[model samples]
Target: MKYYSTNGQVAPVSLEEAVVKGLAGDKGLFMPEKIATLSKSTIDGLKDKSFREIACTVARAFFGEDIEPDTLDALVKDTLSFETPVVPVRKNCYSLELFHGPTLAFKDVGGRFMARLLGYFIKKQGLNDVNVLVATSGDTGSAVANGFLGVPGIRVFVLYPKGKVSPIQECQFTTLGQNITALEVDGTFDDCQALVKNAFMDETLNNHMALTSANSINVARFLPQSFYYFNAYAQLDRMGKAGEMVVCVPSGNFGNITAGLFAARMGLPIKRFVAANNRNDVFLEYLNTGKYTPRPSVSTIANAMDVGDPSNFARILDLFKANEDVHKAICSKISAYRYTDEQIAQTMQTVYSETGYILDPHGACGYQGLIDSKLTATETGVFLETAHPAKFKETVDKILSSDIEIPAKLQAFMKGTKQSVELDKDFVGFKAFLLRQ
Candidate 1:
């Protein structure tokens, strides 16, 4: 399938080009020139299929004949080694456990899928090396690092704000050596994102290395994330609870919830979507006022969702036709709610006391969003638990008055020492560091 830029200035590109180039030359996110809507028959067939089979069908519809059938099958197999189960958290609330992957976060699915696809494309083009650039608040760095680690013909560079992410989140990225390198930017996530975007548009950097991205802005990252919505539905259906349900997503860059909306467009029986947010509530304000505005991000306990200006808002606009009237209808189906750090802590404690579910600060924000959105009556509301509670151990412990044991995977990570250089939030300084490296 061919992809086009949002601005209508750039020429269309093949799936190969879209996957490799990431952002279009016009500096817009790449979107399919045409979207293949799921037929009734396709949606009906998905009910009985395995998660892997369903993913293959959904992915193949958009991918067309771009990837080899066997290669795509193998990639799907490797990508879904862990299960994404929707478990009961309360009488009317469910929790989508998306932290089962290697990095223990929702980004794992996208990261693994992108890494494998990049590997396939590099092999096809006979290219020996490439650079993958990513900007992260928390989980994204580790997910991308682990996903691309030691993959032949690729080096992955992850940029994250220093002193913003959780301790475990930091370790998850810095501890990974080999093909993975982490950059600690002494700025907000917006700064890291800006630098990455500027680097992609830089003529010198583009000439020095073949630059790509693993952030949600990439089609690769955006597409694989649709699988969880499928898995959530399948799990609910298997439990004989297949009615229309609300999904509360703790949104940061808004990619995860947008992926869910994309699946709904593909015929998932979603009743509504709730964008659960922390201090950064641009989408929240947009949902309430129908006016898109920019603001500075406020640091919160749920640091990952602290995005004042989400890049994926472009895709959200494209989904709703970029018209205020159309967005009103879309907002009817999507409700946004922002929570405070105190509320998140209270919700975390309450869930631990009542349901025995230990939610990280981010998940607590999602839980609180559902309550604030007045979805307590909805029996099928599923709040996305994007990370393991241990990732934010200090916050979780202080809130719940309990200690979380580090998982074996995280324990192993402690053995690998961190290697990173602190950098000022300046493009010139960052560019110099990249040059020296």
Candidate 2:
């Protein structure tokens, strides 16, 4: 319904305002003013429902108060056109295959949902045009690009680090030429993220263009991610394995895992969570030392989770209150693990060899986290395989020593010529470019 800024310096606003103005004026992420819990009967009902049905139910809980019931239903229906199946990867371990969407990544649901929701708000307000600024390490760019592709009043600008993303990941966004523009920033993911944030705070840019973020900072972008978590639980419930479930998420900007925490708050019956990281272990370090230290991200095989300063960490702090309490609560329900590129490669190879399950580098981090954490026999581990393996064709091929078939969806993306603007990591240059547009 209503949303409050995590920084607490700004007044609460409606869902429409939060969706349109991504970052608060005080530079804080917007959070729901209240979390609504589901009745046990309602959670029980999800066991027999389709993914869309479950999603509509969950979406209504978060959005029904503000959006019309019929409109929210249609939004959930269109956004979740694809399924995220839970497939077995090992004994007592399941991989929540979230890469089945058009972009073949977990962000598809969020991106598509936000696109439709934002489009609705813009049309309702009769705005001429709205600009969406997103910074992606990998999957997010493509997801957002395609999600908003040709939507009537929205233009999406996806900013990503030059040469850091996988070839397929880069192609997926850069090649799409209508209403979607890719900015190849000559810096890390953090730099691209900073440019987006700085653009949102710039008075000239905001006055010139209605700039909003499609990154996890936007409530519309991240809240819909809760859909898959509820759907994951429903699937586990169907198999009678939902009793003791540990969900492992390959976290980058921490948005995916943060969504799971929100689901848990809404009575999702999750026993605990594991945040799997690759090289960029700032959150892991925080769990170990109770200190939040962010540095420049290091390039790794799992490039998507290569975020050094996750913006959603603020939401986690707001959810749990004081840092000490946040630390305690997070440590209690969530255990974090970090792995290197070598470990990710080894895990990918081993899982394919043993289970015949091909894992992308990002998913490998999640699989390794479950192995390293040692789930009890009574606990069923479900790791979010965030992206399709084919998206990292070269890396997967090298590790497996076999060619992985690219899906028709991805093969089509590769055929389009990449069309992206190169920019230095400076905000002024980025600002001038936007002002020119």
Candidate 3:
């Protein structure tokens, strides 16, 4: 399949080129030239299929022409070692638990898929010293670092804001000593993201090392996320509630929801979408006023959703720009709601008290978006529980007045001593650091 840059400044490239070159020359996200729609019968038949079968079907749509069938099937099977179950939390409401992976975050789906795909391309071309640059708010660092850890010929540099991420989230990546190296930047998530983008466009850095991103900005990372959306629909289809299904996403960088938009284009039968935002609500503002103004992000209980300038917003705009009235095109299909730290805390407490269901701060936003949504009696809602509540155990414990049990996966990470290289959030300094390596 041919992939086109959303900015339209470059020629169309193959899927391999799109995956390897993370960002376009014009600083746009890579978008597939064609959105292949599945047959209605195929969509209805998904309920009877396993997650691997459903994922292979969807993966075939995006990558079948580029990759051989058996190789692609193996990649899908290896990437998805766990199931993303849609659990019932309330009447007509469900939580698509995505925290079952190694990192216990939704980015695991994309991160692992991208890692295997990149490794395949590297080995195919006999490449060497392929450096992956990823910027994280909180969970992304852990997801990407753990995903690419120990992969031959690939070195992962995880740049994250210092003292911003949760202690548990920090341990997951910083403690993993392998091909992964975490860079502690003394700034916000936007600063870390800027450093990565700057490194990608720098001619000197590109000449020095093969630089690529594992952030949602990468086509390989975010596109694979659509697999879970199809799986969620299949799970809902089994319950006879897929007729008027509304899926709410706890959105941060907009990549997760962008994948959903891609799934909808590919005929997922979703009624519409709701984007849940924390205090850093740039996308929500765009939905309300049609003005996309990005500023500095503020720290919140739901640290993962704390993104001010989302890179995928460009792709969202470009996706709708091709149709009539860009703003109208997007607003018609998406509804957005923003929440404060207090509101997020209230949700985590109330939901646990009422239903005995734990909600992390990010998932709280998604759950509340559905609660506020004026859905019809027959409409069913599924909000993505993006991460495990224990990830932010300090905040979750304080809110619920209880100490949550940290899973063995997280506990193992905490046992190791952290090793990181601290740096200022400046491009020149970052370039010099990489040049030294």
Candidate 4:
């Protein structure tokens, strides 16, 4: 399938080009030329399929034309080595646990899928090393670093705000030495994102070495996230609770929810969506006022959702076309909710005390969205548990006044020494560093 840039200056290009280039020449996010809806029979078929099988079906719909069937199937299978279970949290609310993967975050599915797809393109074109630049608030750095670690023909640079990410989240990426590098920017997540975007747009940097983003801005990275929404629906379908299902996602850069919007467009049978936000509630403000205003992001316990200017909002606008229509559609199918740090902490503690379910700060925001929105008796709510609680042990432990055990996977990450370079969040400094590399 062909892809077009949201800016509309660049002509439509093949899927391979879109994936490789990441950002279009016009500095716009790439979007599919057309979204194909799945047949009702196909959606029903997913009920009996395994997570891998269902993911493969969804991947085939978007990527089959670009990748061989066998190759795409293998990629999907490898990326989803672990299952995203829909666990019961309350009477009608469920948590889609997405922290079962290597990095223990929802971004694993997208990061791994992008790594394999990029590897395929690199091998096919006989290209040299490609540098993947990603800006992360928390989980994304770890997810992308571990996902692309040791993969041939690709090197990953994870740029994150210094002292903002959790200790475990930082270690997961910084400790991995081979083919993975971390840059600790002396700014917020938005600064790191700006540096990455500037690097991609710079003629000197682009000419010096191959640079592409692995952030949600990349079509390859964000599109695969739809697999989670599909799998969640499949699980609910099996349980006979698929009717009037509302999927709530913790909104950050908006990539995850954008993917879900794509799924709904492709007939996922979702009744509506809920965008859960923290203090950095630019999207929430838009939902309330119907005006798009972006400012500096404020720090919150849910660090990942602290994106003042989400890169994928452009893709969302493009998806809906007109501004009024976009507002109406989003308002109709999605409810916007924002929570403060206190509320997130309280919800985390409350959910644990009531359900014995530990939620990371990010997931707490999602759960709170459901509670604040007040799901109807007939409506079943599924909120995405985006990360393992252990990732934010210090905060969660303090909130619950109990020591949370670190999973074996996270403990392993702590054993390695962090190896990250400190850099200022300036385009000139970032560009010079890339040239030196």
Model 2 ranges with Cα > 4 A deviation = 322-324
Clashing pairs in 1: none
Task: Name the regions of candidate 3 deviating beyond 4 angstroms.
Answer: none
TM-scores, all candidates, are 0.96, 0.99, 0.99, 0.98
Reference-based lDDT, each prediction = 0.86, 0.93, 0.93, 0.92
lDDT of 3 at 298: 95
Q: Give the alpha carbon lDDT tens digit for every residue of 361-412 in model 1.
A: 9989888777776764435788899998988888888888897899988778
TM-score of 3: 0.99
Candidate 2 minimal-lDDT segment of 10 residues:
322-331
Per-residue alpha-carbon lDDT of model 2 for 1-437, expressed as tens digits? Answer: 68999888999999999999999999999999899999999999998999999999999999989989999999899888889999998888999999999999999999999999999999899996899999999999999999999999889999999999999999999998999999999999999999999998899998899989999999988988998989998999999999998999999999999999999999999999999988899999999999999999999999999899999999988888945677888789889898998999999989999889999999999998988889999999999999999999999999999899999999999999999999999998999999999
| Model 2: how far residue 431 lies from native, Å | 0.7
Q: Return the lDDT, model 2, position 25.
A: 93
Candidate 3 structure quality by residue, lDDT tens digits, 44-102: 99999999999999999889999999999999899999999999999999999999999
